[model samples]
Target: MNANHMNDIRKYLKYSILNNCNFVGHERERNQIFDLIQRTIRCGESNSALLIGPRGSGKTTLVNDVLTGFHKNKSFVSDAILVKLHGLIHTDDRLALKSATSQMNLDNAVDGKVFGSFAENLAFLLACLRTGEKHTSKSVVIILEEFDLFCAHHNQTLLYNLFDISQSAQAPICILGITCRLDVIELLEKRVKSRFSHRQFFLFPCEEDSKESPLDHTIKRIECYLSLPENSRLKINGAVRKQWNTILKALLEDKKFRSTIQRLVDVDLNERTLRNILVCFFDQL
Candidate 1:
């Protein structure tokens, strides 16, 4: 192949990778998140939710989409303060609360106040939430990623305080926890467990049916990607596009390729892995 051909192939690969894949096959999980967001806004009180799923199962993506939708709809949670924090970074309860308060832009207000213990930090966060409520009509949603790891802290202070604040009539704060382990909730203290109960959302791998097998799902995903029209960013001629589709069809027919993809999909059906596999095939071209 000529240098121009190779560059064009690379452009297509880049475009495919950068483009946001349309969310598919998770209607139930999506509805759960939507309901939670709606309840938090309509009730004018805080709510808590826990998202349990395996890695790359689209938990984070689903929550993000809901947040984006909430921001777009002015009549709903448009003015709501959305704060996203990873549990890996702020492992300690006090530190996480401090970071959250900073994200809320309440650092100046709590500046000079010493938070020597978990109680103090929790109090500060509550105070900040109340202040936020007074200033804006929107509620606060705090999303904690890798939630199980954060639960390993002493006394489970972070979870306790977050749930406690959500129970209050004032300072509407919502706590959304994302974790890979289903049994992580079992590790929570009795009080925290009771509070976090009845709000868990589980996302499992998509099940294969007679109409659409796992391999079929993978092919559909690839087709959606390859169907993107060539624009200024990615220029693929008619012949090259045809050749690419032919190559993908050949791969789909290959028994070993189909078996490998099926096995992976059966284990943990996630789009990120499927996209990576497609990118590897494009690299060879």
Candidate 2:
């Protein structure tokens, strides 16, 4: 293939692999989080969970996939109020509360009104959600991205209040925190810990099978990512895809290539690492 063709493949591969959410791993975590949020939204039972994993473990993808599924449901679309707070953007409790209020569309209520302290304003917002009829209130789903940063806030009031809300059966609130920090659980105070559901999920890269010399689902993921449809942008025929598959087959069958992959597995051949390898391969092509 020429450099232009290779570049096209690389660009498409990156987006295809990235936009592909039908990953082979994390089935258990996906189901658990899905059901947790469903119960909170449907049954009006509050829930909280923390997703702890290093980068490229598909932590964000898993939540997004599950939430996307919920988004398809008519009731979920109508009843759910999603408030996403990022630690990088909202540096402290005050800013976090302000953003939350805005995301929840409460700005109009306080429009042209005096802005109260963070605690008072936050409590007022929570009270508004709580005032709805039991089992008929809008379900509030709060997702804290880079949750570890939220933990470092002074006094941890945001975490405390959110956790407190999730402990109640009347409030249909679900709090999902995504963080790479392993010690995030330790950051919570003793009082905040009591309200938390203590439901935590850990994610890691998939491992190779014990019997086969295969790379588990890694190769499958690559194939799924690179295969172009008949009407694909590249306008390449099935011949290119077949040739690519043949190349993959030869590499897997080659003893030296298998050894090289096994060595890469030592440092961890996660999705990100595999993508980097493909970039180099495309450059050489």
Candidate 3:
């Protein structure tokens, strides 16, 4: 290909992979989460939230977007410290809390402290919070991914400590748990469950509007990406655009193609997956 053609291809790939994909179509859930975070920041009181959704259903993406907004705001960025933990990485309760304490960069308080015991680790976390209040007046926003894995721990000390600390700590501390399993809450211990108070947000798959089918919605999203302005660097050639239309037509008339789309939608492959599938097909074209 010529130099200009190569540049256009590069631009197209960038737009397809990064620029176009965002946390889309979760307006209600996004608003509730944003409000909770704002409330915690304003009141200087800790808040714990549970976000439940299936895999690839945009729970993590939504939370990341909210965090990005907070970071962008000058007034909130200074007072909020974002910390993320993967539950699968830290299976043990003590280890998870210790890891959080370490993230706070309170080495002076955490050093030489034996985090092997749950109480010691919990103490370290509290100390870190106290230090945060005294020094930076910052609130720690902890995002726990794979929350179901964390709930599998036997003792449930980690959940207790987190809820207790959030309630008692002077500086606000928010624990946002993201899990795929719907019944994960049933796994929490009784005391922890009561303490948590079931502050949960459920993210359902995006549904088709009254005027359109799921397939139609998917087609519309694909069309939006393909319809990027001519002035844009990302160029979609005639052949690729023709291929996309062919695929859509197949989806409408061909039994096998229709079944494939239906299966993916039934499994909760919403607009996000639609974009990914189209991008993959476009790359081949």
Give the number of the best model, judged by TM-score: 2
Q: Cα deviation in Å at residue 177, candidate 2? A: 1.5
lDDT of 1 at 30: 86
Instruction: Using lDDT as the measure, name the better of candidate 2 and candidate 3.
Output: 2
Deviation from truth (RMSD, Å), model 2: 3.6
- lDDT tens per residue, model 3, 161-260: 7777677664577889999899988888887887784789988665443356766555455555554344555466766545545655555667776678
TM-score of each: 0.77, 0.80, 0.74
Model 3 sits at a Cα RMSD from the real structure of 5.2
Tens digits of per-residue lDDT, candidate 1, 1-285, equal 367876776776667665654555667778878887777776766788889988877787778767777777876544466777788898887678778878777788887877677767666655555534354445778899999888888888888877776775446677889999989878788988876745888886564433566567676666666554455355657777667667767866789977887787777657677677767766776
lDDT of 2: 0.77
Instruction: Please give the CA lDDT of all the candidate structures.
Output: 0.72, 0.77, 0.72
Candidate 2: misplaced stretches above 4 Å? 1-11, 115-119, 126-135, 207-214, 229-257, 283-285
Stretches of candidate 3 exceeding 4 Å from the true structure: 1-21, 114-120, 129-136, 207-213, 216-268
RMSD each, Å: 4.1, 3.6, 5.2
Model 2 poorest 10 in a row by lDDT: 207-216
User: Which is the winner by lDDT between candidate 1 and candidate 2?
Assistant: 2
Report the Cα lDDT for candidate 1: 0.72
